[model samples]
Target: MPRWKTNLIVLWFGQFMATSGMSMIIPFLPSYIQELGITDPDEVAIWTSIVFAGNFLTAFLFQPLWGKLGDRYGRKIMILRSGFGMSIVVALMGFATNTWQLLILRLLNGTISGYIPASTSLVSTNTPREHIGFAMGIMQSGAVAGTILGPFIGGLLANFVPFQTIFFITGGLLCIASLLVLFLVKEKFDKKKAAKTPNISVLQGFQDLRKVPQIPALFSVTFIIQFSLLSVMPLMAIFVQGMHGNSEWLAFYVGLVSSITGFSNMIASPLLGKLSDRIGSEKILFIALLGAALTSFPQAFVNNVWQLLILRFFMGIFIGGLLPSVNSLLRKFIPEGMESRAYGFNTSALALGNMLGPITGGFISGFITIPGLFIMSSVLLTFNMLWVQKTLITRKR
Candidate 1:
């Protein structure tokens, strides 16, 4: 097998383990906080938001720095750095006696986390340009598959074992992922050539990349894609409850509704990626955005769980198209040596969207209700589609 293919296969597992481990603990965070002795319902909610957002907050701030370092050193090294660092911090979360301690560890985990982005950068730089989209799509599939399974596995384990033990298991998975990358994935880095490149500040690098025009527009598309998709997530379970009525199976239904989207997304990613390789990523992105908006709009009017499930499934197919296309476009537009840094900025934009989406969704749902929030998400996606049409498609024409 080719070296790039080898890297892709190994890194796919690495991405899977990293993402699965992270997700394993996320669904149980509120219960863990309550285990730390915070009994008030409102206080539990407040701390959950704070602890959950903490990771993304620091990740947004520090992603560029890690990217800069990756460009200077090697992308493989950055992946190992993040993978191992997250392993230690997450394991230590099991030992925390209070929310403050847990929050601090979460912040540290965010500060050091960039394994997925680093892996993406490595694959993008190493894979043949023509195959970049397929590579990204495969990587995304691995991540989504992990996401789909993590909570189910975590839920099962939670029933049999303590939450703290799950954290330890999550850490072990991360460690195994880092070890796999260390032993299996290989990158050809020219130390002498990297040393000779001019050192620029992160801010300067951002400005220089923005000079390409498409970079910033692509970044905005990434932010909006994440923002629109995730804004509905916090309320999804509630929406299902309303439709299904009170029952013992509510949690199971909610989990099914959530994981179903990821299943379609995983299946669609590689197919759309190959299509993008043939038709051009710009075209794929526009159509995907339009499909996503169309699917989202109807979701507001769905009166039952099955209707909502079907819409979300279709939405996932389009959602799969968004990020891979964005990454492929970034590779086309970014300067040769700055791939890691450019991806870092894109990752930061993604993290910012992840951080804000739930907060904005929770706040907006209060005023407009969950169904109304779905309509708003559809509107935002429409605006994002038009932005792409005007900026990329029209200009290309």
Candidate 2:
């Protein structure tokens, strides 16, 4: 096998462990909040979004810094830094005695969270141009697979082990994932170029990227994709519990529903990615956005977990194509030598969406039902699709 292929497989496992470890604690976070003694329904909802959004809030500020550093030092080192730092920060969450402590730790976690993005940058830059789409699809599949199994394992383990122990286990897994990267992944950084590449401010980097025609539009798509997808995260578990209505296995059921989407996502991403490579990423992205909107609209009305699961699974099939397509397009447009910075800015856009999505979803839930956030997300995605179409037309002129 080629070195890039070897890197892809090793990084795939690393991505799996990192994503799974990060997401394992999410399914029962609201319950954990209650354990920390915030019992008000409204309070629980607010805290849920807060804690979920907290990491992205800080990540929004730091991703570009890491991206710049990656360009200078090495993307691999940045991935190692994030993996190890997040492991330590998350493990400490196990010891938090108050909501405030948890919230702060969550913020700190965001400050160090970039392994996935860094890994994506590495694979995108290192892989052969002809195979980039397929490789990205495969890479994304690893994350989807991790997402699929993490919640299932977490819910089951929560039944047998303490939440604190789960945090520790999550941390250990992250540490191991980072170690895999340190030992297995190889990058031949040009030390001469890296040393001579004068340091540019993040603002200057964004300005330089703006000189490119499609970059701003691509960045908008990144934000919208993350915003629409994550709008439901903080509410999914609570929504599942509502459907379940006083079950002992609520976490398991929640995990099942969450994992179902990822299962479908894992199946669909690679196929769509290869297809996009043949036809064009723009078409796949447009179709995916439309499909996601159609599927998400009905999720607002589901009366049972099965209905929700079915809709989400189909939604996943569409959403699965989105990021890979976006990444492919971004790589296609980014100037040579700026892949790390462009992706970093793109990551920042994603982080902004992550921060805003949950916070907005939480605020909306205060005014309407949790299911209502689904409708809002669908509507936003539809608007984004139209925006993309308009941008495509404008680009031709």
Candidate 3:
């Protein structure tokens, strides 16, 4: 195998470990907070959102700073910084004596975490253009796989271990992941060249990125894609209940229906990515969006769990291609030396979307219905497809 491919494999494992470590902690977070002594139901609810989102709030501000550093220092160093830093911060969460300590630690965790984005940036910079799609697709699959498995493993571990012990185990896994990257990944960074390169402030960097014709459009794609997809999450269980009503195995069915998307997503991402490389990312993106939009509309109208499950599975196949395609296009549009910064900003947009999606879904469900949320998502995606065609396609024409 080529050196870049070897590096890709190692980073894939690292991404999986990192994502798994993160997810494993998430299931136990609410319980951890309760254990910290907050008993008021309202206070617990409030702290839960604060603790969950605190990391993203800080990460939103810090990602560009780290990205700039990555551009100047080295992408590998950025990955190490995030991996090691997050490992220690997460481990420290186990030692928190109060909600305040835990909240602060979570904030620190977000500020330090950027391993996956750094890895993605590194792969984009190193991999050949012809194979970038395949590389990105495979990278995304690692992340998806981690997401799918992490919760199950975490739930199982939670049954047998103390919550604090789970945090320590998660931290250890992350530390090991960083060590793997340290030994296995190779980057031909030029210290002398980086030294000579002028330092660009984060705001100025965004200004520079804005000057690129394709960037704003590309960033919008990231934001909208995340927003539309995650909008379904806040009410997925409730929607399932509405369709199937109460049952002895409603939780099992809900989990199965929800997880089926990840299963199909894992299978389809790399295949579609290779297909995109053969035809074009633009063509694949267009088809994927159209398919997602079409499939999503029927979900709002499903009469039973089976219909919903089948539609969601198909939706997953289409959604799988979106991010890898978007990332691949970013690689094409971003100036050669600034891949980290571009991805950093893109990551922030993604975090923002994640923050907003559930909020938007909750709002829609309040005013209309859960099914209406699906229609709203479909409309947003359809509009995004048209926007892409106009900005990226017709402009070239």
User: How does each model score on lDDT?
Assistant: 0.83, 0.85, 0.80
Candidates 1 and 3, the one with greater lDDT:
1
TM-scores of the candidates in the order shown: 0.93, 0.96, 0.87
lDDT score for residue 312 of model 3: 82
Kindly report which residue stretches of model 3 are placed more than 4 angstroms away from their true locations once superposed. Answer: 25-50, 95-102, 156-163, 234-257, 301-308, 362-364
Instruction: For residues 1-397, write the lDDT of model 1, one tens digit per residue.
Output: 9999999998888887776765555446656788899988556655665676677789899999999989999999999999999989999988999999988998898899998789999999899988988998888878766765565566567667888998899899899889989998999888778888999999999998999999999999989987887776645656787899867556556666766767888899889988999999999999999999999999999999899889888988888888889999999999988989999999999888877876677666768888987888899999999999999999888
> Which is the better candidate, 1 or 2, if ranked by lDDT?
2
Quote the lDDT for 321 in model 3.
86
The reply for model 2, stretches above 4 Å from the true place, is 144-149, 393-397
Instruction: Kindly list the per-residue Cα lDDT of model 3 for residues 24-52, writing each as its tens digit.
Output: 54445555677899987546545655665
RMSD of each: 2.1, 1.5, 3.1
- Candidate number of the best TM-score: 2
Deviation (Å) of 321 in candidate 2: 0.5
Model 3 residue pairs with clashes: none
Best by lDDT: 2
Q: What is the Å distance of residue 58 in model 1 from its true position? A: 0.5
